[model samples]
Target: MNQANFDEARKAEANYHNELYSDHEILEPGTWMSKPVPIVMELLERILQHKDHVTVLDLGCGAGRNTIPLAVRLKGTNSRVVGIDLLEEAIEKLRENSNKYDVADVIEARKGDAEQVDILEDAYDYIAACGCLEHVSSEEAFIKVLERMKMGTRLGGIHCITMNTDIQEVERETGRALETLIELNLPTEKAFSILEEVYDGWNVLDRKTTLLSIDEEKYEKPSQFRCQSITFAVQKI
Candidate 1:
């Protein structure tokens, strides 16, 4: 996507997320933000085995779905989870949810674009970017973000990422193909190739791709969305 197209798509995606965050309550059943991602929780357990006090960075964290739970798990320890999202509504909701869950002290919610945010080198013990990397403005930005994630992580730390690749969408009413709109959409094979290249020499603890299909409303139209969802976890050597 060019800069103009990328800006438009980014605006639309941010608006969609802002509306969702405004309309639904966190942890409400049946919603995408209903609960913390199971794989992230499982990975945290593994991290706890090695370190008691941890610092984590959660890119594209929406309304604290995973961030709040992470903070709750790390509560009473010298641990912090920094959650960043592009939508202001998501950041606001995340702060509210964190306070509601009594994990506010451990969570720092910030509004920022994941691709543009500055990640300090060797600053984080665990970094997660669930369903968010594909929103980057371009393929180059996506790869750059991964490089930053790698640099931000401390030795022996883990990075968990989940993103949709090879997205396909069609309007339900007209049965016409629609642009996926999100930036940085890549083929499944190419996405993995980039990940392997960026994370070369790192220990790939887990990697898998699953085909997913869902019906949802997009750009004010009913649509069917399909993609290969990639979940990868790696540890810094």
Candidate 2:
């Protein structure tokens, strides 16, 4: 698909999220996960060990799940995080939570597509785009966003990305598989193939590909689908 098509897909996804949040207050939130992913926090800790100041970008930062705690951890280090989400309510809720944690000064929130948001060259010190990439409707759009993120990171900068490589969706009532949105039907091998090219010069610190699932019923769906999640924490060369 072309850029225009990709833009339309993003708009549609944004509309979906807006509708999801329409029933409640921006700050009316529940836990998306039990806690911050330990590995992600560990990596951030290690990255901050040698830096006096850092700039972090948290893409698809839903409800400050990871953003708030990271800001608290990086407090007094002159570090700041800018969270970008397609849902305005998500960003607003993130901002509200940041204030509650007294990290409002360190966490800034923006409403926009993470892939389309502009950043200065070599700007971010660390980036996280967990549970986000599958939303990109086409391969071309995904590659463009990945390239942009790579270019925006400083040399030696680290990125933590998690993507659902291939997810077969089923109807709410029927277990039969249905087509996913646009070109998100990417298989596991294909997703890795793209990554092989995307991180050519970068060093992979940690990598894993597996089913993205939890035992919590709250996080379960009514449909029968298999989600292959790919995670990578890499440093720019």
Question: Which numbered prediction scores highest in lDDT against the true structure?
Answer: 1
CA RMSD, predictions in order? 1.2, 4.0
TM-score, one value per model: 0.96, 0.83
Clashes of each: 0, 0
- In angstroms, the error of model 1 at 21 is 0.5
lDDT of 2 by residue, 3-113 (tens): 666566566556555554444333234533447766778878878787888899988887777888789888888888999887877887788888888998899899887
Cα TM-score of candidate 2: 0.83
* lDDT score at residue 192, model 1, on the 0-100 scale: 94
Error of 2 at 152 (Å): 1.1
Q: Which residue pairs collide in model 2, if any?
A: none
| C-alpha lDDT of candidate 2 relative to the true structure | 0.75
Candidate 2 positional error at 218, Å: 13
lDDT of 2 at 30: 56
Query: lDDT (0-100) at residue 16 of candidate 2?
Result: 50
State each model's CA lDDT, in order.
0.90, 0.75
